[model samples]
Target: MTDPRQLAFAHRRSADQDRLQPAHHPVVIVGAGPVGLAAALGFAARGQASTVIDRKASLSDGNRAICWSKRTLEIMDRLGAAEALLDKGVTWRTGKVFLDDRLIYTFDLLPEAGHRMPAFVNLQQFLFEHYAIEAAKRTGLVDLRWQEDVTGIEPTTDGALLSITTPVGSYRILADWVIAADGARSTLRRLMGLGFEGRVFADQFLICDIHIKMDRPVERWFWFDPPFNRGRSALLHRQAGDVWRLDFQVGSEADRDAEVKPENVAKRVRAMLGEDIDFTFEWISLYRFQSRRLKRFRHGRVLFAGDAAHQMSPFGARGGNSGVQDADNLVWKLDLVLRDQAPERLLDSYDAERIPAADENLLNTTRSTDFIAPKSMASRILRDGVLALAASEPFARRLVNSGRLSVAATYDGSPLNTPDGFTAGDCPTTRPGAAALDAPLSDGWLLAALDRGFTSAWFCAEGISADALARMEAASARTTLPVKPLIVSDATACTRYGAASTPACFLFRPDGYIAARWRSIPPDAIAAALARATGR
Candidate 1:
């Protein structure tokens, strides 16, 4: 068949313009992928306009990243694209693991009820990007310049100077800040001579997306040393549009080009299916696993995010999810600093917070990679033994590492969080520096009540002192900074949030991470916490 990538482009082409005119923008993003577009939307949500430049003429064609975690969906929701994505995506909460065609175990993600988003959604990366691109366009705050390639990046005294080459010609842009959301092969990272250090595994993995009519349940299926392929691992996941993604552990010795050929791909599919089954190949690619990251994400005014800041093996589905989180973490800080609501020093916290997150993702992916692709014969033997024991032993089942999947990375030691001083019998569902857990409220979930800035949640009894309420309201009205006060009246909400004790309060940052909590509503204490949260 015909290559889908060669078809007519869907995005608007860049029009010719005068090259000598230099442009200036508050923020210029050097990539239009999901992460970059989401970053633009993040800025747009905060009334910050950004220009998004991408080398590609349109969204990607293949199904690159298929799994989006709950936190990612929340970030998309904040950007106004989550509903659109959920409508077009396939939602799955169950997974099955097998050892050589023998069923080892089955697990369910157990998505919580009343939460605004599910645990995970399986959608093609291209389709998600399409949704993001359209959302960015609707905002009118994002200037998306397609076919614009960023060739050079120079850190300026104020921010950064970027050299962009488009179909018209090369042009220079001066911006107060620049975000490099470019993918793994980031042009800005390369031009800046940044080093991404890590390990490269020896095994090669082949990913194929096929359009076929299959009765397989909507769940993740992972096989170790399956009958179709001896001594190799395989993964099968269902995507929307009746497309299925299959991954095979093709050893390093296999030729990459030969493995992706239609005949070779057909041979592998035929092995999985019987001689009578029918399927059409949509896309195929070969990739080797790697865990690498930059030492720091912020270099002067140019901030790196997504695959540009960190790279990890795909075993955990952390690649895209973590990238989206990176965007989420940086945008709020960028907005704060740009709006002068927070000091420039506040930007350093982005590095401190997200670097650790990247490290955690790298560690998880590394463990999954080691488990899936044992380095030595002894290791492989141990792996097989564990798999064998997992079939019968309950304890061994916990040790099986088919792919840890993705979850929200907590900023345990984040400097932005105000430590909880007052204690209760139960732990607060949302801890300091942890992503706020969604809970059913009287009208909506807790996440929906949060603002884009600092939100102070006051859980009080039916009748509160008017003086105390006045103090809290006065603190909220102090500035134009993104700060809001929310009161929880229902007793169920108070109990569920572990704030049943009268006057319990929780402070959350714009990204939904809890910044601080108080057992009693103290006007002075809340003001101090907000001051520190905004880098006062």
Candidate 2:
């Protein structure tokens, strides 16, 4: 005989799922955060359908992230949302660090000819989410279902099944693939039994968005001292116009309940002003820095991006930037799989490449955090010494500012990224050893061959040969690059971007960066690069 208790428990479990005939799709993204939205837009960019589900009842109301890196801005530019963000956000080229009212370090992002974009852009996270949501809506490919709570996840041979409970009813969604960008406490990650391992900073921090009545230029200012609070630090960042993001170190020994109080937060901000800042506090919250990353970003059909994959301290503003990069790495593979352009082997590169980038950023962020908020006397002394050196030396300042770094995904051993005639140390730029990260990508394969007047942003050099003409024709039939085989005959233009003499070929990726450049364009290499970038 079956026990009534067991039967009831099973029924309750099924009821929690509240599914209605399991919906099916090519891909399902859990969470409508910036990363999930970026993934959705990626699907649209590749002409695929994705269903994004989020538990949030409404959009983010607070200032979560106010700093955007150059790479992220470029991505938004491609997605057709940068216009709105740029119009509202402030621009800053320099970041200054002050130790007890004395300038200790000043770093400038606008360097002399190295990168395609600057180190950072100051904007609120709400504006970021607002624009991403609007851009995703225009795509007409994403089915964003908010107020939908995921209760269970079940994987199948074809894909995985998601059981979600909405306010209206329950439903099941079958997805060819699933991405988890559901923040630190990700339900999808937990359901998959994935682990996030790292250290949580012992110090507590108070973050507040205040409308201070002051006339300060659009620049990021950081103060490291107890002048405002004993043994603590403060950061003031401009978000759009009057709204500013201010973070005050609440001390390790401070009571959490007292620190989170709005009155106490105002008191701290006022203290920083000495007399009175006369600021209206918008929102106040307490948080701590952590150095944690997931062991694996992928688990069969379920993939992780953004905070789901890892979480680092916001010292260098690495979290959202890394999350956007995660989307960039993933979207291409998903598009390829959807179009059947490449084998599933291509998807393997996502974890291999992105995990390393995440780990690298993790280390840099932790070091910066430790340097700023040292716990021990010895560590503090060492940090002060380094800060002093950075204040005086331009090289040291550049190194310190390099932590707010951005990069493109370069899968060294991935089958997609070929090992052609391009030598290992043959980097064409000065981007601090991470060549691919700093380099810009084109729409598709770029063949830079100087024939008479070889010219094209992506591909250059075409000759009188029938085969070369045929190769251009073949390229036109497959990729999205405007000039598949443009015939450039301008000598002056050839030397501008720094290319070899005539008859050289350079294949470009969809993001407009040179992927494979050689002495001459090989037919097979051209076809492979096109296939990799376009997924068709």
The lDDT for every candidate, in the order shown, is: 0.84, 0.68
Best by TM-score: 1
In model 1, the Cα lDDT at residue 412 comes to: 79
For each candidate, give its TM-score against the true structure: 0.94, 0.83
lDDT, candidate 1, 1-536, per-residue tens: 24334534433443324535556788999888778988999999988999888888756867899999988998999888898789989998889999998989888886456577888899899888878877888999998887778888789889887887777667788889999999999999999999999989989999999999999789999999999989999999999888999999999899988998989988898898777778998889999999999999999898999999999998878999998999999998889888787899898998989999999999999989889999989989999999999989999998899888898888978888787755643464566777887767777878888898889888775645676667668767764464688887666667656766656788888999888887766666777788777777
Predicted structure 2, TM vs. truth: 0.83
- Tens digits of lDDT, candidate 2, 1-536: 23111221011223324544665678889988889998888778777888888877666657787788876776766566677777777877777777677776676766544344556677777667777887898989987777788899987776898888876668787888999889888999888777789999988888989887677877778776647765567888888768888888777787999887888877777877655457787678888888898998878888899999999988787898889878867886777677775567667767777888888788888877776678789988776666567767655554343235444434454444444544445434411112223332232211212111112232232324666567666654555333346433233333333342555455544444444555555656666665554433
Worst 10 residues of 1 by lDDT: 7-16
